[model samples]
Target: MNANQTQINSLSAQSNPTPIVGIIGGGVAGATTALHLSEQGYNVVLVEKNDSLVSGPPICHLHAGGNLYREISDEQCIELLKDSIESVKLYPHTINRRPTVIATPNHDQHDPQSLFPRLLQVQQHYKQLIDLDPSNKVLGEPDDYFKVFTKQQLLALKEQQQPAHPTTIEQWLIPFAQQVDLDTLRYPVVTVQEYGWSVFRLSAQAELSLSLESKCQLQLSSKVTNIEFNPHQAKPWAVSIHSQGQTQQLQVDYLINACGFRSGSLDNLANIKRTRLVEFKAAYVANWDDNQLLWPEVIFHGQRGTPQGMAQLTPYGKHVYQLHGMTEDITLFKNGLVISDNDSQPKLPTPLLNKIDIGWSEEVVAQRTQSAISHIAQYIPSFNSASLGGKPLYGAQQIPGDDVSLRATSVWFGEQNYACIETVKASSCLPAAIKIAQQLKLTGLEPSHRSSAAEESSNKALTESDIEQYAVRLARRRGYPEALALYYGQ
Candidate 1:
């Protein structure tokens, strides 16, 4: 046997083969942690109640700089930029290389220039990252990170024919310029190198990669019934899970809660009290086949939770577009944002939980989707013709605290070897995993001979065609259009 294998076998002979890490939830956060831990020579048991991974929340935008939220701090934006770059590096195939347009309506008080200072700071940070490693140029040239276009410029480009394939940022803006009402917009609209993220494609990569890793035991369609903490034992956490109509127990050295919004539920089971907020949100799907022009993800910014809240239109291939209006009647429902009080788990109202556990009613889906279409039509008048494309991409996300405006977060270490990942955005998953790995090292539980499993798995021979086929199948399985799987401008 090889020296590394001999060392591993010797370790196994001592009754401590490798640390078994039990990760609850198969969302992006959990999958990422499992992948990283397994790569580091830990046996990972990833338990998810769903049949597929990354089947939670609608993640359309990469949030490269937290550009969608105007109210968030610049520090948060910079962190987002860093995290997003790392995510793109890990899952390069999932990114849709398209710029996003951030426009301010005339009714909004904030000017487009108000965003320039923060944008400039983000740009500089991006440039530094590229300097550190040229491969960090995922967002495109840092010099062209953001561009400003006045109403005159947009009007001038309104008549320009949309390119069959958009190479320049301006070409990507032609579709929006033609359809959007220029009079209602502010003087300048900012186009950033923020790209689109395909959750289905990300799911495909994670699922396929984890399947190939023998160290990771991905338990899909498995529900964690209970968890017991025995700090004195070699395996501190005893996780009882139900899968395939059978109940089984798994003894794990480390327990990671990456359950997204339901993370607090596991904390409650362990009797760990934590203050958190859970918000249920959904984005609608609409098909605009009438217009063949490709468009960048467009954002018409406004105050949150108001009638004229932020409106986002994300274009998927095959003329399918996802829509989000951050108003009470649309994406944000009544009592959608709930906080943990006496218990760690915030109790979402029964009806909302039903929509989560069960599925949303067809009537509700039609109503909300139609509302979203009309909301987008206010900005892009021609969008009124867009019809409901598929079921809404929806889920609940947990915020670390009550700060609803918080966009970027990482891992939080609790008692013992237990860690809870608070990933507000998909990009935060990688950093969270890295932090958890660091924590594991501090415990001195990391194996002596670090396996190259994760590195090898990450560099596995997979072509773009492989990803497209798997992503399309995943999307269709999840009741979404195949278009949602295909990257725009690919």
Candidate 2:
């Protein structure tokens, strides 16, 4: 069969005249989206509020893009992740070759004693549900609320049901196990029960930003506040910006909301509040020592059918580590966005964030230190006797929010439809940046080149962005758009 005949080809688009494009947000998603758009031949204006010195890793930056394509079973999500990984430029500390595991606390082995005491009071209620509504039958399936599969069945069914390339934490570990060893899989197996792949702290994104600055016009600290869609004859869109507390506007023919966490708000300003969005306040802990951990039985915990939290490990080589997390409530679903079980309120104002919470509580500090120590303890039982010298290692968190903050990321672009949001890592969001880019490219925009004498035109000023965005934005765009659209034959 011809390549076109065998491969499912969606409608293809290319930019002839090149649209004047402006992207807000400079984090990973924004950066990645902007890069793809630029590569497609667009005159692009990229903006961010942070410069190199103060910024932690890009807000969307987290554990490497775990394969998330199977959510819609889009092979393109898989290919897009491969391309993203292949094209991924990291910073100095990243260890690229280590294969990794999206881990979970082994359910059967868990100390049924329950960590949250609140469940104790509901034990009888749980039994009542189990007896009366086996399936929880609320959604029609008998297995959903009930059956917790055996490890063997989980592994077997997962292999059978999940793609050869599993993508989500559920798939990494569930029939909900979404586990796929990267082509670069490399990690040691301490025991049969505790084998895992390793991934490490990599900083390729920093390189991407530098590359963007070199090839395109990137306005640091230039936060865009408004956008005029199809704005004028000279420029189809005009973007309002806020930088250094000063406000100004720029002209462009196309606009991409690449601003990570701010993406939803920008869309909302553009009048595209399609579905509800929820922010999650998540946390992580690593070894205080920069030394390699001896044996860490990294564990993640979540129930099957429950779109909840996860734990993914990235090897920092030998002794160091990185763990990523999420909660389903913080994510958008057909029913609505999932919020924290602990919070009764709809939202929590997160004022402080960090890459490292050096200010963590003594208990939290000890727990973090002990978890790694316990892992090391298993291998080096005499570790306490050994002279280990080091001050507390540090990882910073963003002050306003971070990759974990669930607020902006949960924007469901009207039911199955999705655009980019910061925290929506559910393999669903991974390839979306590219999908949006392809659309822009097809719409006559060319990636910007500094050397060329680009055409410039004047356009009408835009009012504060608001609704009617549904008609103009992808929020209302149909068909569960995923990575296949992003990497169309990419």
Candidate 3:
């Protein structure tokens, strides 16, 4: 045998009796889980059906709490954003703290400060929601400016001979009045918290790098066909994997289903009682030549009774940007549980949903690409002038709802020692990983393993854009930024 194969065989022959966690899926969720588990000194075997760790077309712009969610308290919202920031920081380089702005079409002109009253009222509504929920606790201190800001106080900042302490609103809008373009929709540029854009390839690299440490075994391009429960033994699962037209059995103490869209299928194999709903939401990336047109991530709002449901534009620097104007949400499930092939029916809005499924197809991709370009052109007139980058990217995700609320991260099915995660947001992956590790009560680290923590601490000075730059660097090394075009375009 060759030297490299001999070395790999030597490493694989050395077996450990430590508890094993079998994690299915290699997306951010599964990767983070395996990394955390390995850090805690447990053996981890992470299996993915795809060759690469991050499969499917790229998804970009990890949304911090600026505008995504609703019906949750400001505290909970801010916490989620903070979690997003912290999670990205775990990687060596991958996030950019680009400013995000929301722009409404010009109408009756009002001072930018006038919006503070409505914002304050919205905060009060959230405060009431917090008061009603007894279980919800404000864990960390949220941004004071976000929690409390009065119009009178902000106005005083403008009136003062440099008032001692200015509110965040006044600080952000110092040049707001001067830059107001009444003719276009660039009037009230609300500077939100430093929203970071997570570079897709770099993020995948970071997650995979962290997981492939001393204790973790990664199996790519392997499919789990069946899982047998071994309740009588310490290792509770005998997972049967199919790869390269061969079958093998692996004994594992714990099984975590981190399969994002196909999590429901894995759960069913474990005989776990649950239902899964999925949807196909069309999206596209439009790259423009005008660097001056680049502004903070823009969310365009429509007037009452308008057909458009909040369109989004996030700049990925280098004169390229992404656009998502969600068409009618095509529901993949009817009422409750998707039992069989007949029950799991796709309610396709466009024929493209069938033609271009989870993966890309040429004809459907072309149709959806045109649809995306046309939809964004209505609100963004400049899109008409921009050139198409390449073939349009398309993909879908499982629908998250109240029926699967408690199991959004990880939940234990009592019988089989199986846990399933339904992670809708990439930001939730790290926190979910730590939580599942604690839930499983994995053992503490050895003295040698403590060096990992020290290494992480030493690399603490990296910036948000460092990772994006790293992604660009790697992409250039590979001759093109094909996978990273949605974040850092070439």
lDDT of each: 0.88, 0.34, 0.52
lDDT of 1 by residue, 1-490 (tens): 3332332233323465578788999999999888878777787789899999999989998999999998889999999999999999888888898889999999999988989899999999999999999999998899999999988899889979986987898899999889999988987899999999999989998888888876777788889999999878788888887776667777788899989999988998988889999999999999998989888989999999999999999988889999999998899999999999998889899988888889988999999999999999999999999998999999899999889888889988987789999989999999999999889889877753555655575426556777888999999888889999996764
| CA displacement after TM-score superposition, residue 475 of candidate 1 (Å) | 1.1
Q: What ranking emerges by lDDT with the best candidate at the front?
A: 1, 3, 2
Residue 331, candidate 3: alpha-carbon lDDT: 12
Candidate 3, 356-408: lDDT as tens digits: 44345656445555555665566556566655544443444554443422222
TM-score against native, each model: 0.95, 0.48, 0.71
What value does the lDDT take at residue 78 in candidate 2? 29
Query: In model 3, what lDDT does residue 92 have?
Result: 32
lDDT of candidate model 3 versus the reference: 0.52
Instruction: Give the clashing residue pairs of candidate 3, or none.
Output: 93-467, 94-467, 95-464
Better of 1 and 3 by TM-score: 1
C-alpha root-mean-square deviation, each candidate: 3.8, 17.4, 7.6
